[model samples]
Target: MATIKVGVPSEGDTLDSPVADRFGRAPKFIVVEVDTDTGEIVSYQAVDNPGYTAGSGAGVKAAQKLGELGVKVYAGPTPGPNAYAALNYLGIKVVTVTGVSVREAVKAALKELGS
Candidate 1:
C-alpha cells in the first residue's frame, strides 16, 4: 500500500470562512498525511502559504511544493486551471468537497484514494 499526502485550505475558525489573504501575510494551509492501506492518519500539519494568491501562481506553486513534500492528493475548493494542470503533471490528484472540516476531508481523500 502506498502512502498519500493531502492538503486543505485553512479556514480561520472553520471550513466556511477561508482566509482570503495569501499565505504570505496570512498563511493558511493545513496539510495531512495518511496511510493508504489502512485509511489511518499518519500526520497532520500546517504550512505557510508562501506568496500564493488565490486563483494565481500561489496555488500552483503551493501544489508543487506539496508534491515535493510527498502529497499525492489535494482536497480543497476547486483550483484554477493552471494549478490543476501543474498538480496533475506532478501526478497529484485534486479533489473538491464542500462544508467539510479540513481533517474530515483529508480522511475522506485517504479512503477514496485507497491509501
Candidate 2:
C-alpha cells in the first residue's frame, strides 16, 4: 500500500492534541503517515511551527515548513489565502476539517485525499 503523509495543525505534540483552528498560527503540526489502502495512520511526528510567532508571512512560512517535512496533505481548518497559495505552489493537498483532535483530523484528511 502507498503511504501518504498528512500534516494536521495541532495545539500540542500528541495524537490527542486538539486540532488548531488556525493553520498558519498553530503551535505545532502533527505529521501523520497514513496507509492509503487501509486509510489508517501508521506513524506520526509533531513539529513546532516556526511561523506561530512570526509577525508577517506566517502562512507562507508554515506552508514551507510542512513542505520541508515532506507532507503531502494538509489537514486542518481553512488556511489564510497566502498559506493556501503557498501550499498549492508546493503541490500539497489541502483538506478542510473541524475534527477535535489530531488523530481525528488525520482520519478525515485521509478520507478526503481518497486514501
Candidate 3:
C-alpha cells in the first residue's frame, strides 16, 4: 500500500496574486504532507485551486492530485460532499475537525486512527 498522507489549509487567506488576477483566476487549497510508518510529515506541498473558484471543482481536483501523490488520509474541516466522495473514491481517509488548529486536528486524527 502507498504511504499515508495528510493535507491542511494554507496559512494565507487569499488564493490570488496581485498580478495573477489578470493572468488567471485565484487558487485555494490545503498544504499536504506525506509520511511513512513514523507518522511524521515527510513531503509537503501546496495543492492550488485549478479554476477561478472553489465551486469549480478545485477541491475535487486537489483531492485527485493528492490521490495521484498517494495520499491515504486528509485532515480538514467539514469538507463538502463532492470533496468527500472524491477522497473516498481515491482510497483516502477524511478526518473532520471543528474549531481546532491544523496541528491539533492532525494529532486528534492520528489518535482516532490509531496511527
By TM-score, the best candidate is 2
lDDT of each: 0.65, 0.91, 0.55
Against the true structure, candidate 2 has what lDDT?
Answer: 0.91
Give residue 73's lDDT in candidate 1 (0 to 100): 79
Number of the top-ranking candidate, with lDDT as the measure: 2
> Model 2 compared with the native: what TM-score?
0.94
| Model 2 ranges with Cα > 4 A deviation | none
Candidate 1 lDDT for residue 100: 68
Candidate 3 off by > 4 Å: 1-3, 13-37, 51-55
Error of 3 at 80 (Å): 1.3
Q: Model 1: runs farther than 4 Å from truth?
A: 12-26, 53-56
RMSD of each: 4.2, 1.3, 6.9
* Candidate 1 lDDT by residue in tens digits, 22-55: 3222356666767767767777777766634445
Ranked by TM-score, the better of candidates 1 and 2 is 2
